[model samples]
Structure formats: C-alpha cells, structure tokens
Target: MDEDRIMESERHQIEQIRELDLEELQVEEVENLHGSSDDDTSGRAYRDEFTFDAGLASLHTYLGEVEDTHHRLSFLDSGAILNLPLFYLEGVVLFPEATLPLRVIQPNLIRSVERAMSLVDVPYTIGVVRIYRDSFDGRLRFASVGTTAEIRQYRRLEDGSMNVVTRGLQRFRVRRRWIDVDGAPCGEIQIIQEDLPLRIPRDAFGTLPPLTSVSSPGPSHPTMSNTSHIKRQKCREGKNDFDADSEDSFESELSLKEMRLHQSAVESCYGCDTIDESTSSDDEKNVFESGGSQDSVTVGRSSQSNYQRNTSDALGVGRKAISQQSSHKQEKTRMDWIIMRQTRSHGVPRAFWPFWVYRMHDSYCLARKAADMWKTIVRAPSMDGFTRKPDILSFYIASKIPVSESTRQELLEIDGISYRLRREIELLENFDRVRCKNCQTVIARRSDMLVMSSEGPLGAYVNPYGYVHEIMTLYKANGLALIGHPVDEYSWFPGYAWTIANCATCERQMGWLFTATNKKLKPKYFWGIRCSQVADDMR
Candidate 1:
C-alpha cells in the first residue's frame, strides 16, 4: 500500500509539473506547489568519525580523497609519441592518480568505448580533453593539455548504453587531433615528464657533526627548529629558539679579520671572488613556461642554462666554484641539522626564503607543509607515507581539493611536484567560501560543507542526461529559493528527495536541496551544489 501511494503521488506530481510547464515556473509557482509559506530549508549539518560537524566532515571529503587505494599501476612510456583514442568532456579536468567515471548513452560514445577496449597493444586508454562553449561566438573550444584515462571497469546497460570507470593514468600534451570514420575522436599525444622530489638525503642528516658547547659567544644566527636548538644546547641555558652553537675550536678562536682574509684567499684560489649569493643554487634560474593566467612549474634545463649564463661572465669562475661556496656555507655557517636541512638566501630568509635559498621550494619540504595543512584542516587519515614521497602526495591532493575547474586545470598543466604542492598548499589554506561562478554570490561557507562519502565533500556524478557534475554535499545552505515539488527519482543521495535550488538574488539554478524521505533519519535535509557552478571567493 505504501509503494502504491508513492507511485500515485509521483504520478500526480509529474502531472502537476507538466501543467506548470518547467520553463515558465517561477518562485510564486514554487510557493503555490509547496502550498506552505513556512521556510526552514537549512539542515542539521553532518557529523562523522572525522569531525563533530557533518559539514566539516563533508568538507574533508573535498580536502581528502573520495576513494583512496594504494596501487602500483603502470603507464605508457613517457619517451614515446603515441596516437590514442580521445574522450572529450565538458568542464572536466582529470588529474593523474584520479578516478573519472563515465556514463555513455549515445551510440557514437559507446563505439568510442568499444574501440578503446579493443586495443590490445597497451591498456584500454583514451585522452580525456575538456570541451567548453565560447561566449563570443557560441563556438566549441578545447584545451591542448589533457589526461589519459585507463578503463579500470566497464559494464553494459540493458538499454544498450555503456558505463565505464576509468582511472587517469598520465598527463599528455596533444600534438594533433582528428575524428575517425567511426566518429571517434583521436589524438597524437606526448607524455609530459614530471619531476622527482628534491629531498635532502638521510646520509646528509647523519653525517653532520654533533653539537657540544658554544664557543665564546659566536654570532647569534637563527636555527631551524626549537627542538634542534634544545638538543644541541649544552643545557637549556636560558635559550628556547635556535642559536648558532658551535664548539670552541681553533676556527672560532681566530680573529674575525683573519677569517675574512682567509675567506678572500680561498675565493681567489677558486677564481670565484665576488660570487653573487643568488646565483648559486643547484639550478637557480626562473624559467616560466606558461601562457596568460597560467602558472608555470620548472627550473629544469632552462634554469640550468640560465645559471650557466649568469656565471659565464665571471671569467675563471664556474658552477664548480659556486657549488663549493654553497657547500662551504652549509658546512660553516649553519649547524642546527636537527632543526632541519638548510636552503640558502635569496633574501632575508625570513618571510621569503628562510636564511635565503629557495630550499623551501624543494618538493619534500613543500610536501610536509601541504600534508600538515591538510591534516590541520580535517583531522582524519595518516599521511606519513606522503611526506616521504612528494610526487604522489602532490597528485593526490590536486585530484581531491575542491576548487574551480580552471584552478584544477592549472594543476594538471603544472610540470613540477614542488611547484604543484606549493600551489595546492595555497589553495588548501584559502579554501573557505563556495559561491556562484557566474554571479559570485556567497552560496555557502566551509563550515557548512559535509563529507557524505570517503571521496571527500565534492565529487563527480552523472545525471540521467549523461552530463557529469562535480557536486559538493552540504549540511546547510543559504540565499537559495526552492523550486517546484521535490522529486525522488534518480537522486544521487539515496532516500533523499531533490528540488532545484536557485540563487534567490539572481534566480540562477545553482544546485538541488535534498530532504530525507524517512523522518527518523538525521539531517532531515541537505544540499548538493555543483562545484562547476561555484567559485572560490578567498575574500
């Protein structure tokens, strides 16, 4: 009887909707449909093992991975130039180590999947590019950079449609593209070579001299961490932060003048006199490989070349001399190894460069910071393994962090792990507001976000129309006016009925308000907002 009533009610609702005509329905019609003026559309935000507030937990899903699995999968050779099948999507940017689920309804789309599966040479892979509509001429546009999706799972629907779960394997730059006779898009792709972590070795830490006693009040330079400062001090001795504590050796006993003269002698012998402190890093040139509004990520060959160019003017001096100077600075100037490994000075080493080198720009250091920031924001899983491996952590966070599509696309185009992690740390720190991408209205705040799944607060879900929406669940939302009657059919969240939610200010449909069918269930209501429809208002 309950099922029958539900069926009859749904039929009546559909008839009413047809009568109202969705195109012409307005807020007044919505009010008439609900038949009530009462409005307490907000919900009791979620709570989970990770957080006391469901909104906070939901926010964690956006910060952390939606579906995390430890795998050792392989990819196509980075050195090779290969032609692969293409799967063009709208407003989607796939990152490496990320999962993309596709629901194919069209015949050509199904054939495209079939063709990809039939390939026996490599894996079932296809280049996924984002296609966007232009405003000026209403023409189609696509990005040059894209990710290769490897079909991890596939199934056929009873209606002859196909469903595929693909994992993004590698990032590629498309050299050329064309459509085949079978109507499948294809691309000639070259895999981008990603950089490894710039980590300080364990031996570097182990080989340093142990501190014993401070020598006759040496210059009080800064130390790395306070813990190192405490360990190296003979006693607490009224010291808390780091200090340049070295033993009472002959070098310390020498007059400051004599030491300077000796330093001059060493530089003269090496032909590195007056070496600019800035031009001495392993690769210390700034090479930006980017277009408008795009941030570049590199100091590779180009930087090495720039470094050589900067030093070429110093007739007899070369990289060997600078390396020696850098090593000398490491061995003589700094000693709080326990506090941390050191990077040198481009500036005061305070706000910009801690003691001046771009050492903080190292992938390993950035990894630690990014991980800590993530943990601090949403105290959930253990990221000890990621701290050791920066590359994996960098990609993992890039895939999960709920920012705008353009922001994520920028991450996909980035080449270096350190640069990527640095950008991610910035995003994670400033992640607060969710607003309308079109009108920039404040639709929700970070406190209202809820983690309904392991994937994180925001995730991709395909509608019955075959359009994929990256939706973030929230315990509550504001400035939203409910539209029409709530419908339960094909709802993303089970047992929750959905009604279109439009921005009350601009009347733009931003997302849907979900209300539970069973009154006994917690949250009684929630909201699922489209990530693409929202912007990150850092302000």
Candidate 2:
C-alpha cells in the first residue's frame, strides 16, 4: 500500500509536456516556457527536447527580405531634426527586428496613425518611445533611444478603432519632442547606425587538401600541382573514393606520428605534459566517429579545449624541421583563429541560411557563458542551441528575461548584439540569488523559475478590457502560501486554475500558481512570479 501511494505521488509530481498543444500557444507565451534552445550546451540534465514554431507563420507575407537593406533604409531615412508622429508606451520598449502590436482608440493616437499613413515620402512610419514615471516628480519621462516602427498590417473596427501590427525597423535618438496642433506628440530624431554586418572572406579558406599531406614519405611526397590536379578531377567526376586499407594505415602510423609531434611541441612550449597520445587518441577517435565525416571538416581551438594540434605534420619532417614547422604551424593557427573569431563575434552569415549559421557558429566562450546562465535559471537543462542571428536571439531574450521594465528597456537601448547578450547572460548569472525586497529573505532560487507561458517568463498579456499586464512567471515558490481557492475565470493557462500566493514572511503578495484539476494532465502545477515582486540584486 505504501509503495502504491508513493508511486501515485510521483505520478502527480511528474510534469508531462504536451507537444501537440504548443500550436495553441502564442509565440511570446511559448518563449516564457522554454529558454532559448541554446541552453542545451549548459551541461544540465533538464534537457527537454522541445520544438517551437515562434508563431511567425502569419508574418511570412509581411517579413521583408533582410538582404534588401535599401527597402528598409528608404522607410527609415530622415534628416536630423525632422518631425514625426509618436506612439508612447508604458512598460514596453521596442528593438530593431522586433514586432509590436497596437490598438489605436485614443483620439491622439488615431490621428497620429492617420497622419503617418497620409505621408507620401515615408508612409506608415512612426516613432515608438517608452514613458517612465519619475519617482520624485511623478511625471512621465521618455527614453532617448526609440525605434522606428513601420505599420505592416491594419484593420478598421466597428467602433472606429484601428488594430495595427508594426515591425521595428531602426533605432533612433529623440533629439527633441513637441506637442502637435492635433494634441499628438511629435519628435525630432536622428537615426543611429546599425551595427556592421559580420562578413568573412571566403577566399581566405582553402579547400581540404588531400589527406595525404601528412604522409611520412621523406622527400618523395607528391607536389602541390599533382595533388591539386587529382582533387580537381575527383570534384569534376564526383566519384572520389578512399581505400579503407590506406586510410587505416594512415590513421595508425601517419596520424599517430603527427599527434606525437603536436603533443611534444605543445609540452615544450608550456613546459608541462599537455596530452597523452594513447588516451587522447581514443577520445579523439570517438569524437571523430560521432562527428561522421572528414570532408569539409574545419578544426577549431580554444584556450579551454582539452587538446590542440600544432599542425606540424609535413612530409619528411626531420629534427631540424621541428622548430621551423612548429613556427609555421603556430602562425597558421593564429591567423585561422583570428579569422574565425572575427567572423563569429560579428555573427556574420558565412554561407546559406540555417546550415551556414550552424557551420560557423562556434564561440566557445559565448557557449560556455550561455550554459552558465542556463544553470542559474533552471537546474537540469543544458543550453541546446541558439538562433543563428544574434539580433533575433537578442529580441527573444529581451522578451523572455524575468527582469523589471526598466531593465528590459535598458536592454532594448543597447545597440550592440553581442553586448546585449552578454549583459543578459550576466543578469541570469546574478539573478540566481532571488530575495524578498522588503526583508531580504530568500524566496526562491533561480532553479525554481519554471516557464509557464508561451511568451516566456515575462510577457505583456492583455486582459479582457485591453489593459496590458506585463507578467514574470516562475515555477515553484519556497516561501509563499496560497491565499484563496483557485479561480478559473480569465486564467491564461488553458484548463488550469489560478490561486493567489503571498510571501509567508512579509505577508506581501508575490504571485500565483496554476494547478491542473485534471488528474491525467501532466505538470499538475506550476508557479508564476510577478517580476515586480521579486528583488533581483543584479539589477
């Protein structure tokens, strides 16, 4: 009876994710539940295999080609000190490459939209700025950096209100602001330069030379012209074959010798034993086998990688060649590394979509940083992978991070993609120590953060009356007690009931938890913490 009871309890605790139900969730809502797929490399155990749609299917028609920079530039171009209608928002700041949805009902905003649509030179363009109320004066203040939003779609409602969707085009500084004759706020703005696109020179990389480059055939090695001719012929015919016997012999003898030379050279440089040949060979072999191919292979090194080859395996390498070969190898590695780092740090596209991004995306430091951040937010999952484009990933992080409005606004203003990501990563690392603002009592650890919504941990959810509620969600609370019975009405998580929870120590309202009433449903319960309530010391 006790074993059965324990099994029952375990079943109730296990959260079963329903992959099919993801289609019903909004893009932002989905982001709240799952961190960027980049968390897989974090080395955590909570690696939940999830597929997200991002709900961008509808925007296919409206998303302009990124390569057509001229098209977007035309819409955003403005001389310094030009006047434009403004749309003011509270608790929200838009970034370039992000999407914002708005409803125009107020007379001032409606006029602004109309005036924008009427403009011939720059139609459907408006300035979006965030308003913050000063604590001392209790007056609203606008941020300096605002984004230019281009209206992509619009609809007229029966009540004469306009429902419009806008995509952020460019970042601009608010040079000045004035109230228009029609009671709308207008701004004189200066366009900010978009960060330079990272581009790598394709010609700098040479095709893979024949694997025979490392053969120990004394001075009898084939010349470069002969090798090049054979490779070119194979490419033309598209029927290249490698005999297993030859490959096996090369691996056991030539490869081993090359590795020995590399290991010895490294040891000599650092004055310490760097790698053991037999042991390292087994591991390298396993990695090579799992990696599955030698063609198109590029080797990368890092300060943290367990092993690095000096690339000193030329044919007929003698005692005198070791120093010269090592020097050449070192120089080559340095140059290749510099090129790779330059390409990756800028997040430039090297090849075609998806595949190219994956091919060149190897920032070991960035990957390790992401992994550490994942450890703070959730306990088990390692960072799986991140989006190819840094800007897209930046917006996703801005939308999902469980930080206050001011913090998110600060993130929005950062022009550098890598800088923004690094800042968020820092926030994640420090946010682990969550404490009560009033008493400094620890409420929940970062691991307790559970993604309950599709929009991410923090999202701006509109209520029935169109009032937007920016919420930060968490999974479970350590120092909170449930106040009342679960309420079903207007609950965001479908099929679940919400109950208010408060801090046990201070008796202050913290957040709520949604519980599944259905016995068969997985994730019997999860918590949602208000971003406003929790104190993030990192801020």
Candidate 3:
C-alpha cells in the first residue's frame, strides 16, 4: 500500500510540473525531475535530498562553465579590466530567472557582444553599469557596483544595432577607471562575493483588548457579612455620591483613584480580588465624571462664534500640554515631527530656499549665484537690443561645477524658468539692459519664481485649469504630499502651477501646491489633464 501511495504522489508531482509555465520552472526543477521514475516508492525523499545537493553542485558547475565559456567572465577576477565603449546600463538578474532581451546600439558595444557570442557557445557575460551625470562638471559617472550579464539571444537590426537577450550571473564593482589610447572608457573591476543578510522570522503577538473596555470598570462591589445596617447605609451613600460626582469631576478624581489603585495592588497580593473590586468602583466613578466634563468643554468651545477669541488661548495651552506629553512617549516621534516641520518650512531639497539651505553648500551657492546673474541679465537693457547676443550657457560652463553627477543632474533638471527669463538674464549680463517697462522689478526670473496661491481658507481656490491635478499626480506617483488649501483658485505661470491642498481630516495645511517641473514631468504632461485631486485621499 505504501509503495502504491508513493507512486501516486510521484505522478501527482509530475502533473503539477506539467501544468506550470516554462518560465516558472527553475533550473533545478528541470534537471532533477526530468527523467525520474513515476513508480519509485522512495522517489519523494530521494528527490528532495537529491535536488538540494544537485542544485548546489549544479550552481558551482554552471559557474565554471560560464567562466570557461566567456573570456569576460575570466577577466572578472579580483581586478579585472572592463571596456565600456558605449552607454552603460544597470542590470539585475536572479539565478533561477530567465534571460532578458536587450538592444545594443553603440558600435563598440556591438563588437564586444559579437565577439563574446562568437567565442562562447552559451553567449553570455557582460558588465552592467549605472549611468549618472556629474552636476558640477557635467561629466558622466557610473556606479561601481554592476552585474555580469550573459547574452541569451541576439538579432541584428537593419541599422546595424543588435537586439539581444541576456541574464545576470554575478555582481562586480569597478576598482579603477581609465581611458584607452583611442579615448574609449575602460575600467578594472572586482567581483563582489558578499552573501545577503539573513532574514529573521517575525514573532507573532496576539491582539490587544479594545481601549474603551480596558479603560472602564465592570460591575463589582465589596461587602462584609458582619457589617452593621448603618455602616452599610453609609457605604451606599458614598457609592451614590461617587457615581453622581464622577460625571463632573472625572479627570481630577480619576488621577487620585489611579494612585489609590496602584497602592492597593502593591499592598495586598493575597486579597487581590477584593482590592481590585474596590479599585474598579473608585475608578469607574471618576472616569464617568471626567468623560462628562470633557464633553462639556468640547461643546462649549464649539458653540462659541468667535473661536479665536474664546478658545484659541485655551486651545493653545492645551496643545502645548498635549505636545509635551506626546514628546515623552518617544524620541523618534518628536524628531520626526521636527524634521517634518523643517521640510515644510524649507521646501523640497534643492528646489526652494531654506530647505535648499540644507543641500550641499557649494550647490546652493552656485544656484543662488546663477539666479542673481540671471536677474542681472534679465533686468539690464541691451545696447542695440536686436543685434546683441546673450550668453546664458556661458555662466553655467564658467561656474567650475563640481564633478558630482547628482548635482549636475539637478541643475540640468530644474524647470519652471521661462526661456524669456533665461534670455533676459543672459542679455542683461551680456549687453547691460534694464527690465522691460511692463514687468515689475519684483518679478523674479523663472527659476527663482515662487508659484503659490494667495493664502486663504481651504477650498477658496479651485484649480479649474487642472494644473494642480497634474502636479498632484506627479508628486503622488513619486510619494509626496503637498499641504495647505490656503486658496480655492489655481495659478499657472510658464513653467509652474500652484493650488492649495489641505488634509481633509485634520484641516491642517499639509503643504502648498505640488511642484514637479523636473525630469519626471515629461510623460505626465503628455497624458494631459487628468484630475489628480479627484482620486481618493491617500493620507
């Protein structure tokens, strides 16, 4: 019977595998089970153990095969040289996953791929590089860590570009970069052999009781059999007074009751049941009174027409007290709020002031200097305005920008500044012109423009033009929240849009209009006016 059962299980496993997609089948699965008997009594046990060892053995053998097959894999030693004659791209691959298709466009890269494909029967092994542009120097930089990609399929395009499929095998880091005699980029790279961190299993804690029930006391009373009628009457009166006063004097009385309960719990471990009964009665009475008093305060405050005059001062004091108590709960929570406030006051990093102040000082200083130069260029009148040429790009080129790619990328990415502003600034710097008569001196150049609605109550400004909708979509997709519904109207300039958005629940101004005039906006703008505000409140 056991033999029959094992045979049935083997058949079932095969059936399951047959039903799965080709891509879903891991390499170990295909190798170990491909020709296994469907009738062996010990097949299941044999397969598990066999597959485990087989998988590891296969991995080592596969690595060896890859190394022998691709010369690039051989070069991937502690210090292996790499040639990146064209665009570098970051690639990620899993061992059990299949290869991905790629298109090779650059001529030098094409030759490298062709050479590898011709040399190896498996046609695999190439480096992946992350592309970044330095902000200061406007030079391209690649991340050190990269994956080894193996070519799986190759197709030649009519234009000579090759379409290929490749799989990542291992990770490598660039150790040193150099230029070939012909000016092509090359680097010495090292294989990174660190294992991933072990993940601990999560411990499960059971659910907690509801806060309401936990805070309240159930019905319980203490009485002695020998108590006199008079004493009993006195106790009844006390209980009645407790119940009556509880509603009006709960907060103050509850504190005292809690203290008494703590002391009682500490004093008598043997008579815990009796002490608990007494403590519950006292606490219940105090809690009832406190709840009522709090309700009254809320009602009174709401009923007043002049909330500012009648309740602001009291609310302010109450808020301060609450905030102080909250601060005692967790340091991280307090720090988070502080950081949030700072972020709000400063604006997003590198986009606006105060917040931009926190950015790399050099970058901030450069941006500010650029802004000033732009202002001068825009305001200064050109001598013979028609013939004079502006030199805006020269300012950027002259700044001796840092070699950091991220900084240069940010400068290149800034938007919302008008071409007119750029041109005016350049003209001012080049030809010495003053501001046009129609434009105010206060009118900032495009990059320096603050696009925000006039401050007012929530819903005062409705973004009819759907600028806020677009901005919100871009910001939300990238995980951002804009606070404040100061005005109900929408404001749009050449490269910027503004509208007020407030948290629906708290009514606190969460942020101003979403700002996106960056690299992420192109596709969003192409989609045209989709109302982002109409989406569910993500907060």
Candidate 4:
C-alpha cells in the first residue's frame, strides 16, 4: 500500500511539472507572435531575373534619315537648324536612352514647357547642353557636343517649376544661342547624324600580309603588322557600327549583359590560384568530334593554344605592371602629404579646395596681424589689485580686434594662453574679477544691494538681487553692450547700455549696469549702465 501511494505522489508531481512547462511555452509563444508578424512584413523577396526591352520597335517620326554608311557621316547640309535655348546641367546620358524623371526649376524653362505642351503638335527640336562650368557670375558653359532630348512627360509644379522626362535621341553641336529675354531660349543647333560605314576602309583593309599563312612552319608569333592591322580594323569597324540600332543595343541591352557576365566571371575567379588547363582543350576536342570540319581542326587547335598562352602572358604582365604602378602611386601620395604638412607647419594655410584656400589664408593673415597690433595696445594686470584697473585701455583694444567666433575659439584653445600672449589676457581676466569683488564689497558696505521683483515678457514675476559678478573685459570692445539705468540700482549686461560708470581714480570707464525704473521693478524701463574706467580701476 505504501509503494502504491508513493507512485501516485510521483505521478502527481510529474503532472504539475508538465503543466508549468506548458504555461512557460505558452508565454514564450505569445512573445514570439509579435516577432513572427514582423518577419512576415520584412525582407520581401525581389525578382532576381529582370529584363527590359531597350530597342526601338518603330522608327521615330522625328528622327531624320537613318544613315547606312561608315565614318558617321552626317547630312549637315540637308538638316534643318532647330533654334533652342539651352540650360545646362552636369549629368551623363547616352543616345537612345530614356530618363524617366527630371525637374526643371528655371522661370524661362517653365514658360517653354507650358508653350510646348499647349501646342497641337509637340515640338521635336529640343537641344540639350552638357554642363561644363557653373560660375558665380550666372553664366553657364557647356560641352560642344550635346545630346538631343525629347520630352515625354511634362508636369507643372505649384511653385511654377516643371517636371519632365526626356529621352536622349541623338547628339548635336550648338551653332549659336539667341537669347529671348521675354520668351524661352532659342539657339541654332547642328544635329549630328550617324552614318557609319558597314565595311572597313580600303586603306585600312589592305590584305594584312596574308596573316603570314598560319599553316606555314614558323615561330608561331603573330606578326606586329598583322596585329596592328587587326587592331586598326577593329577600331574602324567599331566606329562604323555606331548607328541608331547598334547604339540602342550597346547602350541599353548588350553592354549591360556583358558587364554582368564579366562581373560574374571575375567574382567566380576571385581567390582562385589555379585554373583547369585541360578545360579549353577538352572543349576544343569536343567541338572537333562534334562534326567540326577537318580543315578547321589544325587551325582551331593552334588558335586555341595560342589564345591560352597569350592570356597567361597578358595576365602575368598585367600583375607586374599593376604592382609597379601601385608602388609609384604610393610614393607620389606620400610626397604630396609631406609637402602639405610642411606648408601647414610654416603657418601657411594648406590648400584644401581648388580656389577658396588662398582666399581663406589671406583673411586669416589679415586677422592675425590686427590681433597682434591690438595685443600691443592693451595692458593687463600683473598682480592682484585692491583698486580697479583702468577700463578704456582694455575696452579700446578689445573693440579693435574683429575676430570671428571660430577664431576666438581657436585663441581660447591655445595652451598656456596667458604665457603665450605674455600675460596680456590673464591680466585682463583678473581685472574683471577684482572689479566685481570691489563692487560687491562697496554695495555690501553701503547696504545698497537691492532685491527687486519684475514682470518678464512671458508675464512671469522674477525676483533678482544685485551682486556684482566678473565679466570678461575683452567682451566690452568686442561688440558687447550694456543695458540698464545709470543710477540707483542697475545691472550690467553685454551689448546694451543706459548709464556709464567711470573710475574715480583713473577717470576711465569701468563697467555698465541696469537700474530699476521709478524705484519699481518693471521689465521695459530696466536697462544697463556702462562704466569702463571704473571697472578697470577696480580690477
């Protein structure tokens, strides 16, 4: 009976543990529920293989005669000169490529867009200028050859700007600009038409010395003349192939595919030390076995071997050239850095930007010279003073130095500034401290220190007491003014003045103060009283 009872107790404990475990799992699942929702919303899969049709399905009506010759011959004589006002902006565009969105913000351009849209038939004579230089003088210079852009979609903004998308059709040369002050820009442009030759020129196509008859027994070296001829032929052919159809394919489809394939091949080969040498041979053999002509067998094998050897030699030469170039570039960069450092150390401001560096250096030099002159005139305290220092000397000198906030900050950051400035600034700081202490003592002795309540601009009552505090003496001449009344009770502040206090000992101004108006604290009537000599003497 005891054993049976113990077994039942064990089963009851197991049941309780399972219940606790289930409750914990339920809580964990509840927490994960929110995470699962986020997972569902995030990391959307993108289509990996996307293709776009870039070729023109039909010949555009606006396009002129499609030339079918080589050398990109344009019928400049037959083409009409379309006058267009050009606004230039820097960006790249290829022929037969359509940019979807562009924002035009000029006033004349907006009018032009409106006029163009209002016409029953859209004008097909828009000229594009490749922006070269943007100047402060409001004049824009452009490249000689610019693509012709055809507006597809035009929209006007609330702010009188126009948004449009233009497809670049062809390139043109600007003949002349006729500026219409009241209307849009008008310019005579020569439309460049491409009519490249289909075959290589007779001069370039001269029988390449019959390629040294590759079948003949020789060193198996491709002759320089043959190579040169092939290279020239390729170049000439490339130039001749620059037609609209060729351009469209090259710009939009084939070039992109080539780039992608090249990138993939490079990435695949990355970090690979060895390539399978037998792969090319096996491929060639397979082709030969798969019904390749007997005449092509020897020629094909030699060509394949030659290609492989050439590729290896080229890669080796490229690596060596790259290493040499990298070493030269590093040396050049180091030399440039050293030159920059030396220039900076000599107190010459290093040229950072192309044009503005010299201007900045000139401004700094002028400011520094003025600061030096001002330092000579100002006398600061040598020892702790019982009486205040004279104020005019400090005020006059500090006012003369027109330093910017950044320059002042740099001045303040100087290590051992007091010693560096020959105790000039230190003395000035000490003078303010002494003056404030003396003022406090005098007010305390006279029982004139008053606590006044005033209403501020925000309709809040503030109670303030008169306690003299140290104010930087240099600030007084540095566009700092005091605001308050002259007599009774006043406060001294920077950049607003009411009453002035002069030192009795030196007959020089000391500091300013703001006094309560009509013996009552009012926000508007309260202003600062300034005294330069008194503040200096006290210091």
Q: For each candidate, what TM-score against the reference? A: 0.63, 0.52, 0.24, 0.26
lDDT of predicted model 3: 0.30
* Residues 1-539 of candidate 4: C-alpha lDDT, one tens digit per residue: 12234334433443354454343211100111112222212212111111211112112211222322122212234244666655453322223232323455657766665554443422533565544223357354556665555666554556665556555555567788766775677567776544321111222223433111112222223344643453455455443323323422432321222322322332222112111222211122211111123211111222334444555555556545445544544333323322222222111111223222222222222233334443333322221221122122222222222221122222222232112233334333333222321232211000111111110000100011111111222211111132222332211221122343333333223333333343222221221112111122323
The TM-score measured for candidate 3 stands at: 0.24
Tell me model 2's lDDT, rounded to 2 decimals. 0.52
**Ranking under lDDT, best-scoring first?**
1, 2, 4, 3
For model 4 the local lDDT of residue 151 reads 66
Taking the tens digit of each residue's C-alpha lDDT, what string does model 1 give over 132-170?
656589677888889888876666778987667677888
For candidate 1, what is the lDDT?
0.59
Q: Name the regions of candidate 1 deviating beyond 4 angstroms.
A: 1-73, 135-138, 200-356
lDDT scores of the candidates, listed in order = 0.59, 0.52, 0.30, 0.31
Q: How many steric overlaps does candidate 4 have?
A: 53
Better of 2 and 3 by TM-score: 2
Query: By TM-score, is 1 or 2 better?
Result: 1
- Write the residue-wise lDDT of candidate 2 on 115-176 in tens digits: 98777767778998888667589687889988888877776677776667677777788998
Please list the Cα RMSD from the true structure of every candidate, rounded to 1 decimal place: 15.9, 16.0, 30.2, 36.1
Better of 2 and 3 by lDDT: 2
